[model samples]
Target: MSTDTSTAAAAGTQPGGGTAVQGHPGRLKPRASRPRRGPASYATVSAVAVFVLAFLAPFLIILVNAFKTSADYRSHGTLSLPSSWNWGILQDVWQRVDFTQKLLNSVETSLGVVVIAVVLALFNGYALGIGRIRWRTAFLVFFLGVNVLPQEGLVYPVYYLFKELGLYDSKLGYTLLVGVTYSAFGTYLLSSVYASFPRELIEAASLDGAGRWTILWRVILPMSWPTLSVMCIFFFVWSWNEFLYPLVLLISNENQTVPLGLAGMQGQYTSDPTAMSAAALLGVIPMVVFFLLFQRSLTRGLTAGAVK
Candidate 1:
C-alpha cells in the first residue's frame, strides 16, 4: 500500500514542484493583466491638442477681424480686439458683396450639382457593383479616364461646345457641366462602398423576388447613407469653392458663384480688407456647417470595415 501511494504521488507531481497542487475543475484560470495608460497615450493627446490649436488660430483671427472696420483693422494689430464691434462693416460688406444673391446662387448650384451627380453615380455604381456585367471593367476604365484627364485640357473644348450650343451664360448649362464632370469620379468612389456590402444580403434579396432596382433602392441605398452623405458634402464643398470654372463660364455678375463674387472684392483703386474677410467668412460658413452636420456619417463611413 505505501509503495502504491508513493508511485501515485510521483506521477501527479510536476518536475519543478515539491507537491502537485490541484485546481478546482469548475474555476476558470486568471487572465494576464491589461496594460495601463502610459506615456504613449499622453503624448498622443498632447500632440492632437497642439495641432487643433494651431489650425484654429487662423480661423479665430478671421472671425475677430471680420467685425473690424478697414481702418480699425489696419490701425490695431490683427490679434487685438476692435475698439467696438463694428456692425457697420458687416452691413457694408453684405451690400458690397451682394452677398444674399451670391448665397442663393451658391445654394442653387450646389443642390443642382448634388441632385444630378448622385443620380448618375447611383446608376453607374449599381450597375458595376451588383450587375456584374461584362462592361464593368470597361466602365471603370472609362471613369478612370475622366478622373485622370485634367479639366484644363477639356476647358477650351467645353467652352467652344457651350458657345456653339448657346449655353454660355445659362445656369442649366453650368449645372449640367459640373454634374457630368463629377459623375465618373463619384461612381468610382461609391463603387468601393458598394463592393464592401455583403454578397449574402444581395442574394437573399434576389431570392425573395426583389428586382435589381428594388434591391438597389431598398437595401443598398439605405445601407450606404454614410457614403452618400460624405459624397454630398464633398461635392457641395467643391462646387461652392470652385473659382476657375465660374471665372471661365460665368461672364455676368448675376451668374457668378460665391468664390468669384468674393474675388471681385479686390478693386482697382482701393481694397476693403474688412469686407473681404467678412465675405470670406460668409463663404466658408456653409461648408463648415455642412461638415459639422454630416461629420458623424463621414466618420461611420470611414470606420465601417475597420473592425471586421
Candidate 2:
C-alpha cells in the first residue's frame, strides 16, 4: 500500500485523491473550463439577424425581380428566381424616360447644391464658431429652427416667390432654392464642429498676421476637409433622391431628375413592375458607385472624428 501511494505521488496525483496535471515539475492545478454562452447571447444574435433580414428584404426583392420578365414576375411572384434575365427592360426604360438627360440633370443639381451649401456652411461656421460674434447662440438657434420647418409649409410661398421672380419651373431656380434651404442644416452642423476646433491654432495664425479669410482658407478648411467631404456625400445623395421639390419646382421634362424620371414610369391604370424595378436598379447604381468610390474617405473621416 505504501509503495502504491508513493507511485501515485510521483505521477502528480494528490494524496487526497485529487488529480493534478504533470507537465511541470511541481503539480499544476487543472485548467478551468470556459463558460458557455447563455440564452441572452443567442437572443441578441437572433434579434440582429432578424433586423438584418428585414432591412435587406426589400432590396433583395428588387434585385431578384429586376432581371425577371413580366410573365415570370406574374407567374412566380417577386421571391422566385427569374426564368430568363430580361436585360432589355433596362434599355427600354432608359430610352422611354430619356434617362441620359435625367442623369445629367441630377448630377448637375446635386453638385450645384453641394457647392453652394458647403461654401455657405464654411462661412457660417467660421462666423458663428470662430468669430464668436454677438448673439451667436441666437443665430445658431434660428438656423436650427429653419431645419424644423416643414417643406410643405413653405412650398406655396416659395412657388409664389419664384413665380414673381420669373424663376418658376427653371432648373437654376430649383437648384438655388434647395441649396439655400439645405445650407441651413449644413451651417448648424458645421458650427458645432467648428466650435470644437483648437483656438490656439487660430490665435497663432492671427499672430502671424493672417487675416480671418486667409486663416480660414489655409488652416480650418484643410483640417476640416474630411468632415466637409462626408457632408458633400450626404448632400449629393439627398439631392439626388429628392422628388417633391423637383416635381413642384421643375415642371419641364428636361429639368426633371432621376427620381422624377422613375416616378414618371407609373401609369394611370396599368404599371410595368419589371421595368419599374429596372429603373430603380438603374437609379440605385449611381449612388452605389459613388459610395464605393468614397467609402475609404467616409471611413477615415468617421474614425478620425471618433479619435478626436
- Top model number, lDDT: 2
For model 1, residues 1-308, the per-residue Cα lDDT tens digits are: 77766675666643333445466333333445798989999999999999999999988888888898777888996888877888777678778878888888888988999989988998888888767678788889899899899878988898999999999977788889998888888899877667667899999999999998899989999887767777787888888887777788888878888888889988899877777778778877888998888888788877765756
Global local distance difference test of model 1: 0.82
lDDT value, residue 301 of candidate 1:
71
Q: What is the TM-score of each candidate against the true structure?
A: 0.83, 0.86
Residue 74 displacement in candidate 2 (angstroms): 1.8
| lDDT per model vs. reference | 0.82, 0.90
User: Least lDDT summed over 10 consecutive residues: which range in candidate 2?
Assistant: 22-31
Off by over 4 Å in 2: 1-41
Candidate 1: segments with Cα more than 4 A from true spot:
1-37
